[model samples]
Target: MNNDIPKAVALRYDRELEDAPRVIAQGKGDIAKRIIELAIENGIPIHENPGLVDILMDLEYYSEIPEELYQIVAKVLILVYEIDKKYTSNFNNFLEQKGGANT
Candidate 1:
């Protein structure tokens, strides 16, 4: 069996208009580390799905995800949305407690 370093793929979606998400960034090994780090720093949600990453890694950056991957990606997007909602709610609550209105 061959062992490979871990990989990561990042995606972007525009819910207002776009029909599909696009491959925003992807990398293996060190670059993968950086992508994950940046995501964490920016409060982006990260889903660990090596199988999905394997499939998405083949796509060119900025290319729309294929229809075959829509179901999987949809699940991930839902998770991200939920996380974002929770974070926003928490942040707003924090601001209110601090006597600062949410902007």
Candidate 2:
């Protein structure tokens, strides 16, 4: 497959507020590039799972993901949460080092 053109799908979920994950974004080619770029700029974790993307692309945007996909989606969300936790820890460490004298 030619990687010159990219493909991506984004999902959003909040267990406390939502019953399941929703498709927040889905795109291919240039749109995929833009979606990836924006995610990077915002520090959101980017996971490349072509198989998962292929399956998710079939679902409609803003609609809750179906029951069958819950397990797979939960694993992906776990990875995202881990990434966020690591990033936050690293950032806090940096701040502590930078504020050594005052802190």
Candidate 3:
């Protein structure tokens, strides 16, 4: 409830299974801390968009992100994709150099 405390929201989208991204989880303060920890532990990309987070915090859990936010959320998804792509490439290169995987 404290404005100074950090806020975080987790989104899940499946283009084939769903129409738009949904707010899978959201919290502030200590709960926010836990959400971030789990995301990092699982290698999920964390995008820092405080203004967007603020707007998203108002949405109900499991609700699709509003249509008005489509453009902004799309940009975030693009960034996440880029980050995952780069990380995957680097990891594959590492495996190749180590003579491990068939990549």
Candidate 4:
């Protein structure tokens, strides 16, 4: 399988986390916890596994995920980045319009 896409996605994840770790961390609040709750609610596989966040991060950094899963991961990351940028931009616009703060 061609590995370039996965590598590029992983690199993007790494750069985003590095550039804005606090924002990323905040956005991930309860995500790991809720994933387990949802899995149990749906009767999905719930093995006695390690933290899903850690697993996913490791996969983002080191694993050669299949193309299908890679696409999902890439799309999710893009969505997250887009939402983050939108939120930040909107907040800045609000502040400017309201004269609440300066950049």
What are the root-mean-square deviations of the candidates from the true structure over C-alphas? 3.3, 1.8, 2.6, 13.4
Regarding TM-score, does 2 or 4 come out ahead?
2
Q: Residue-wise lDDT of candidate 1 within 12-73, one digit each (tens)?
A: 99978688999999998899999999999998888888888989999999999999999989
Worst 10 residues of 3 by lDDT: 94-103
Q: Against the true structure, what is each candidate's TM-score?
A: 0.82, 0.89, 0.91, 0.38
Candidate 1 to truth, TM:
0.82
**Which candidate, 1 or 3, has the higher TM-score?**
3
Instruction: Give me the displacement of residue 34 in model 3, in angstroms.
Output: 0.6
Best by TM-score: 3
- The list of candidate 3 runs beyond 4 A from truth reads 1-3, 100-103
TM-score ranking from best candidate downward = 3, 2, 1, 4
Task: Score each candidate by Cα lDDT.
Answer: 0.89, 0.90, 0.94, 0.43
Candidate 4 residue 72 C-alpha distance from true site, Å? 1.0
Candidate 3, residue 6: how far the Cα is off, in Å? 1.1
Better of 2 and 4 by lDDT: 2
Tell me the number of clashing residue pairs for each predicted model: 0, 0, 0, 0
Q: Residue-wise lDDT of candidate 4 within 15-77, one digit each (tens)?
A: 443432211221133554565566558543333312323344444333444444455555555
For residue 91, what is the lDDT in candidate 3?
A: 94
Query: Model 3: per-residue lDDT, tens digit, 16-58?
Result: 9999999999999999999999999999989999999999999
| Candidate 2: pairs in clash | none
Maximum-lDDT candidate: 3
Model 3 quality (TM-score): 0.91
